[model samples]
Target: MKTALTELVGIRHPVVQTGMGWVAGPRLVSATAEAGGLGILASATMTYDELAAAIKEVKSRTSEPFGVNLRADAEDAARRVELLITEEVRVASFALAPKKDMIARLKDNNVLVVPSVGAARHAEKVAGWGADAVIVQGGEGGGHTGGVATTLLLPSVLDAVDIPVVAAGGFFDGRGLAAALAYGAAGVAMGTRFLLTRESTVPDEIKQAYLARDLNGTVVTRKVDGMPHRVLRTELVDALESAGPVSGLARAARNAAKFRKLTGLSWRSLATEGLRMKRGGDRTWSQVLMAANTPMLLRAGLVEGDRSAGVLASGQVVGLLDDLPAVGDLIETIVADATGILRRLASE
Candidate 1:
């Protein structure tokens, strides 16, 4: 179970519970930490004050090392970085590659920078910018994902970067961990698997809905936030795919306003953030407007448990999962099973 990832983060196992927006909170994160894995708190959904309080609560629940996942392009990115430094967080995982100076600042403050990338080139870029490690997620990952499978993408990134690489996307069991290690990765990270666990904050009915899916139950569509998002094939998702652009934009605008109210952000701040998002890529103004749809829609499904009105971000691995074990039991089983498999292979 010990690997570069374990050594790098001071965790006993080379397993990570990913930062799922509504699911990864203090209780689940602390449970993962207590089980000896690196649990990441999802801060993209929280306000600054909420993040601070959640970090404090995690520290109170467990002394083991953990991480916080945030959006690098957020308006308060620098402020969040400072908070991590002041709180002495063990790891800072970014949803996007952070600026070079931001990486330097975090590293100088003794916080490890681990960004999640979807491509080999991105891994190279972040590694060159002084990231301690990178988590390479493939197309099968939940939420926004690329088109490459992990079996192909993981090696491409491993070849492109010298830093430790954690394989993500489509990983759920110890056999997957063994396979990832065999492929030269330091470890594996799981989001959907962890989200189905007993400690996860997601409602039970929702968990059952995820568990009922088969391998072909998920679909990738660009209707969600103008990006390729993998989610369960729900009626809401089907409707989104069939809806016209005009209707989508109208809904997105309303959600944007609601998100602003919930987060206590002014109209000017939201407009500025939207502009920043637009400048970050080749996104059109319509795409930028649609971007506001993600947080509120996800909140409706994940936090409010209204399945008919919301969309559930899920990995294809949902089909293979059927049970909800506690976080501690899940990690222990994965590590032990992986150890046995590796040992048997060596003996052969």
Candidate 2:
């Protein structure tokens, strides 16, 4: 049904397909947009040029409004922000809290700024900086997540921020949408749920693997890099978790090099970014490197189809999902089910 999120983003449905690197690409984004959901392209894994091309491709595929998730701290973040302005994207989403200047720049260009936050403080900070909205993802969310659960964090953020809040984490169905709405959220933002959909770039074999797991199949561990990351409990994940910080440091060092090569970052620039992360309380150099490797690890599973060697960031909702349906079908089912659930609750 129509909610503030739907009207703000100019989409028919209040649901959102969150940006998952290597998973939420042109195909998935366009499909979700066509399906009446606000799909966001994950720009963390793409170069500035690649992101621009993908945005154009999505525009060609559908005229519906969509968003782009950017690395607010990237070296070329300004360039990427410029691309969004030039493309006239409906919304500009940030993986973390964006700089006040960046937020102002986008708002000046008529782009809606929505940053994903894990805590109430972050929501307040972004709202104070003039963000159009905020997406609050709790501890149960996939990828890099905080320790607060959605049940607690959602209302905390809603109470703290005046802007619209989209509840995320541990949400995979109509029941979740209803729960989020009841919590005073404008809508729900889904990551793992959308990544497991038929339109996602995730391999069929891996998608099947995700479908087979129950709620207990997923685990959150700091072993992946240095930060606590939520991922499937594969054999590799187990090995890494047990390896401890030393091993993680070693891996992070190597991955940092690879990331530099892939993203064309100079050593000076990489070290500067690493230092920024470290100063911001990430602590160790390993944690700094892992921050960048997080996207690459997810790409291994999502784009390359290697579950064993890759880190698959997924929400606990994976256990609740069984089938991979087309984006259109999935959105329709969710909207209809949510409507029915709301009506039933009203009657009660």
Candidate 3:
């Protein structure tokens, strides 16, 4: 149960509840922290002011340390980092590798930077740039994910970096945690597993939709946000995959406007952020437009409880999950089970 991750973040267990947008909120986050695991508040879906309030809310709920997940490409990344520094947030996890200056600033403020990396090279890059640790998620992870399996990606990242690595994707129970530790990971970070918990703020109906699926129920498609987003294979996703580029762009534009109102960002600023997103890699204008689908589309299902209208991001591990447990019970059971598994393996 005690690993470098626990020591680094001052948590009792090496388990982490990932920052799932629209789901990882104050209640769930505080419960995870109170349960003795690292709970990450998803701030990418919130405005700067909202994030500040959320940090305060989490602090009010639990005295234990927690982290905030940030969007490295957000237009106000620097301002958000400043808030984390001022608020004395314990950990700052990024959806992408943050700029060297940002990483240094957070570390200078005594905040631990833990960027989630999909590839070994990214993990190496962040480690070299002074990240305290890395969460390496593989293809089986929910939402934006790469194509490698965790069994392969975890060791690759571990061998590539000296910093502690937390393995994510397809991890549900104690055996998975034991396997991760056996593979030399400091711990396991789970999204779908945590999202199904009783403390999750996701609506009951939507939670039922997620719980009803088997491993084959999820699909990774670029149609959602011009990225390989792994979501439940719902009719909406099927329509997206079959839709032409014109329809996709139309939906994107509409959602982009909605996002602007929700986040209080000016159109000019939103356009500028889109340009940055385009230049970040191979994202085209249409793909940039599709990016809007993530926040709004996710909000529909996770927050509004409209499963037919919104998308449910999930790990393939959904098939293996059955019931919802409180954050405390979930973490305690996994850690205790993992300890037993490890002991038995050693004795054998």
Candidate 4:
């Protein structure tokens, strides 16, 4: 139960409910926080004002420490960091590697910084730059992911970084928690498992679709965002795969415009964010435009509950998840089981 992550975030258990976009809202976050796990509110899809309001709402619901997941390449990254500092959020998590200065500023304000990395080098980079901890998500994780399996990637990151590393990707239960601890991780971070909980705000229909899936239900495709993205194989995803490059670019353009309007972002602002993303990872201009497709497509399914038109970002763990439990019960059960497993192993 108590690990470096628990000590770092002051949570009773080492379990973490990842900040899944559109799913990790105030209700689920507060529920997880109250359940004694570190619940991170996803802020990439939220406007600056919306993020502040959601943070306040979570604070109103639970006094326990929580974190905000941020897009390190967002145009308003500085302002967001300032907001977190001003509001005194306990932690800040980054989707991509954060700049040294951003990490420095948050640490200066006593906010713990945890960047999710896919490789040992990235983990080492952030660890050297004073990140409080790292969440290493492997290929089995939903959304943007890498090719390495957690079994291999976890140890590589552990060997490279002295800071706490939370294992993610394909983790859903207490047995996985014990396995991660045995792998020398500080804890585990789960996105899909938390998203399927009763406390999650995802539409029931969407949850049902997720629950119906099996181990082979998800697909990893670069068609979604020009980067490897793991999503449940749906009709929309199939169509995307079948589309030609020219057609894909056309769709990306339209969605870029839609996302700009939906988020009230100016063309200049979108361009700045796009350029930042491109520079960070050597992405092409076309890839930058395709990147806009992620939020809108995810919103159609996750927020509007449209299965026919939207795509579901899901981990391979969806196969193992069959029931929806309340956040409190889920956390309690996981903690109890993991403790027993650890005890049994130690005695053996």
Worst-scoring 10-residue span by lDDT in model 1:
261-270
List, residue by residue over 73-156, the lDDT tens digit for candidate 3: 787889999999999999999988898999999999999999999998999899999999999998999999999999899999
Q: Rate residue 343 of model 1 by lDDT.
A: 97
* Candidate 2 per-residue lDDT over residues 304-328, each given as its tens digit: 8988778888898888999888889
Off by over 4 Å in 2: 244-246
Q: Per-residue lDDT tens digits of candidate 1, residues 1-348?
A: 789999999999999999989889999999999999999999988989999999999999999999999888776889999999999999999988899999999999999999999899999999999999999999998998999999999999999999999999999999999999999999999999999999999988888889999999999988878888999999999999999989999999999898877766677877787798788888888888888788898888888889998889999999999999999999999999999999999999
Better of 1 and 2 by TM-score: 1
Candidate 2 TM-score to native: 0.97
Between candidates 2 and 3, name the one with more favorable lDDT: 3
**Model 4, backbone clash pairs (residues 3+ apart or across chains), number:** 0
lDDT of 2: 0.88
Q: Count the backbone clashes (under 3 Å) in each candidate.
A: 0, 0, 0, 0
Q: Estimate the lDDT of model 3.
A: 0.93
Off by over 4 Å in 1: none
TM-score of each: 0.98, 0.97, 0.98, 0.98
Tens-place lDDT digits, model 4, residues 240-304 = 99988898899889989998887767889888878877887978888888988998889999999
